[model samples]
Target: MPHDVVIIGGGHNGLTAAAYLARAGLDVLLLERDDHLGGAAVSADAFEGVDARLSRYSYLVSLLPKRIIDDLGLDVRLVRRRYSSYTPDPVDPERGLLIDREAGAGPDSMGSLVAAFARVGAEGDADAWNDFYADTARLAETLFPTLTEPLPTRAEARALVGDDAVWASFIDEPLGRTIDARFTSDLVRGVVATDGLIGTFTDLDDPALDANRCFLYHVIGGGTGDWDVPIGGMGAVSGELTRAAREAGAELITGAEVLAVDPDGRVRYRLGEGEGEHEVTAGTLLSNVAPAVLDRLLAVGTADADARAASSAIAPRDQPPFSPDGPLDVPPVVRERLRQLAAPEGAQVKVNLLLTRLPRLRDASVAPEAAFAGTFHINELESQLSSAYATAARGGIPSPLPCEIYCHTLSDPSILSPELAASGAHTLTVFGLHVPHRLLERFSNDELRSQLQAAVLASLNSVLAEPIEQVIATDAAGRPCIETKTTLDLEEALRMPGGNIFHGPLSWPWAEDDASLASPAERWGVATRHPRILRCGSGAVRGGAVSGIGGHNAAMAVLEASVVA
Candidate 1:
């Protein structure tokens, strides 16, 4: 019998969709090209003979909704860090800005900001910080709840924000303008701006306001936008999602490569290293892959006249009837738009280091545990970030790379083995910004990766009291137990076009204009030109981060579409 839904790609979003649909009594089948289930959210022993399970590729959890966790009964635990961020001054290494949630001057929560700002000798800065965040928090509270619902029209969403000034500052204008206007300190402005640049490569002055859209998603996740650490690395989250899907009767198949997908619900896939191809029929197909990937898959059987003519020759005997009523043929204008869509260029380099012990900081007053526990900013001053961005935009890596570091062991040591835990070993994850794919395009993969690794270590050492290289643990072969994945590496490994972690530049979560769409599915923004198929990944509207909003919305789209379901 044909499956009710065939979800391509076994990422967390796909798993979420599968669990929801299967629980609703739909037969769901999930296929992953990789041997592992999680697309980029998997934890693995990156270094040989290392006892640490690093959350390779994408890290941290902020955008995941609590409702999805509760509804799916996922057994993942997210632990919040008291210290939000600690940034060391490049000129005065002894003094740094530490935003501690626990330390405050008053009973009010704004005390944290007051205390942090006071430490930096920036009088009245706390009020500015509070005011700035209060606005974002308001929007987060109002906008986050609407993500699970149908996509609202632009005007409706604006009305929901209810503040013309807030909308103008955040949605209409560049986020940098808002930051510059609100914060007096360059360090503070840079720290806030970093949120807007996560996995996105755009300048603060970008006229398109792409940075603003990214900033909104970063700050508005889960209403509070707190990026908590998963208790047992990212694998724990994916594992629970896998369990949920399986328990709900969704059949997940790994090591299966989906070669083609038809708008009419036909899927062709091949098993591991096998030559014989298999076909499956689904009442509805949900694609958890990126839009570019889905487009390529659809184009496979319809790219040419010969292929289109032979399409019926390869049709399965028991194939379900194909529907021609929906937008089956890609419109010429839409095709041109797809072609013109800017390829997402990832601007971050990820470094996973197995440390013998946490590196000591230059600031003697700040304990190493406290600084390493939260995000440690390095060379991330506003001027530095702008300089680095400008340099990288012109195909040059900045000398002092802007990056942030976090030690997983400080928050959750469950990922480490008993011996490693007792030995005081920790894993440090560093994310360097402004090292876009274009900067590394000049060198071979190996050569550029080596150069990037050297640059990252140098950048880290610039802020530390001692050279970080001396503290790195050596693997069995005596090689440093450190690994780096560049944007190009992610592009090749994860099939992320241009190595973009968000799949593409995030789209505004609402319709631009009030136009009558054929169906509610189109209005929902999860629906594609093909009616039977829907996007359930980071490429979908309001899609990014670890949030399953896209998956939930995609499932809701199918469930609401009586014609498909």
Candidate 2:
């Protein structure tokens, strides 16, 4: 029942792999345990029967390679670029959000962006972002040749990366420290600093914060920060890949779980309902699941490579999606100022209040765009946030963590159906941080509503002075399951080796290194000994963002395996 290639997990990236392989004329089959595919990128009932985005996890598509879009003819319905940013009070008049509503920064405008960076963090963050982009992007842009080039021997890669020492130094330094020494403004710092810690455990205050800066270099800004969802949701990316894979001639199986991947590359799965076992042997196998998942699968084959990665981070039970990451808590009321602060991601779970109308933040002081664009919200200051983080780290809800309220409807009007818009309603993405999943974990699904509602209402009243209890429709709810989960918050969640964003922590040095441990060609995972069979994500390469470079380069290695053979 098998052919060219079989893909595990129907996550967008996995689908992307299937698409490319199938398009290349390889028979492909993708398997997902869920009846509905699209993994984390999905939407469900907001609460009762209303539809809302389940962006509880993995929300933006900032780095999906464009070649995939063009090559596969993706039916992507982009929500369009409507720039919106939050600023301290007294900045904009309409909605307390600064938006380039008119796309105001024309080329000649030299638009106040760099200067604004200076405003946010003195002269450093502005200059840093500028310089960071210029140098890294240059390398990133030109990487296709080598990354996709046939696999070179370990010796070959070393010669290439070994030439760059200064870049190497940049990699050696702790990411957080790099940012601290460079930026003066907390705004700019938070903006750039958040990247380092975004998807991993590198805390902002972790003086060893350079990891964030290293990660900042990895923000493959979707060729300019346009990471977005297609008309449907992130599902579009997976949809297109699935379609392409089928067209290229791959059979995809959903609701089928493969129990093992042997050292010889045999895939074993449940054949039918109440069925025993079915085995499909393929030329090679790939895993998109966490390394821990792979380890157990490959354990059947006793593959050392699989064993190493799995033991490193994935095997542990109880891994949360957002680990070390919890709901954010801060209160402007605490300090009466705009400062960077986050208390806890657990203990005080954040409840998003999707609205039917544009929130009237028109205080004649704040920017209107901030009211509805990209993870928008209301909040408190730094001290409150810090206090919230500390308190939550100890497992207790702060009576009044600040608030984050966002109306996504105004930014992407299409999120609502004709019926919803006609009713003066829009999509809202509210995030509550520092929420302890255990609090809700203890309650029955039915009884949890009041408890969750009361907690948010109390926090909002104390910190935001807004009545959220009335704003949230009791019937509508997004992914309640994902809402209460955090991958790093608890001790048992799957931990990527070293708590790094990539399968493991990656930095410029790794990227700039050659295929060999010694020189240029040796950088990356190019060393001949570095089996392409076990490559990580595309962004796994030293470059940035979650680009498929690692996969691309690894694919080339697989292709090279053919050539070398």
Clashes per prediction?
0, 103
Return the lDDT, model 1, position 23: 89
After superposing candidate 2, which stretches have Cα over 4 Å from the reference?
52-56, 88-172, 205-210, 271-273, 300-353, 362-364, 367-370, 375-408, 430-465, 474-485, 488-554
What's the lDDT for residue 475 in model 1?
86
> What digit string (tens of lDDT, one per residue) describes model 2 on residues 1-565?
4455566666555665676677677666677766765554444444556655544333456555666567667676566545534533222223232434343356732345544433433444455655654544543443323544444443343344343542432344565455556655544444444344343333445545445444544443443444455565455555666676677776778767778765555677875578687777665455555454555465544443356458897453322232122222645354322210221122323344555444444353434444456544333333344455566556555445434444445545565567766777655544444444333334544454454455555644442224444444444344231133332322122122211234433443234323233422233353322132343342234323334444444344444455556
lDDT of 1 by residue, 1-565 (tens): 8898999999989999999988888899999999989888889989888778999976799888888999899998999988888988887778788878777434775766666666666657778877888899988988988888888889989999999999999998888888899888888888889988877778887889888988898888778877899999999999999999999999999988999888778889998885678889898888888877787787653443235556767543232223221134778776544443445677888999998998888888788898888899998888888999898888887889898998889999999998998999999999988888776557777887888788889988887889998899998888999999988889888888777889888998887775554575676678787778888999898888888888888888777775553
- Among these predictions, the greatest lDDT belongs to 1
Error of 2 at 340 (Å): 31
Residue 507, candidate 2: how far off, in angstroms? 5.7
Q: By summed lDDT, which 10 consecutive residues of candidate 1 come out lowest?
A: 317-326
Determine the C-alpha RMSD for candidate 1 after optimal superposition of all C-alphas. 4.7
Superposed on all Cα atoms, model 2 deviates from the true structure by an RMSD in Å of 10.0
Clashing pairs in 1: none
Off by over 4 Å in 1: 105-115, 304-342, 515-518, 563-565
| Model 1 / residue 404 / CA error / Å | 1.1
The CA lDDT of each predicted structure is: 0.84, 0.47
TM-score, structure 1 vs. true: 0.92
- Model 2 — which ten-residue stretch has the worst lDDT? 336-345
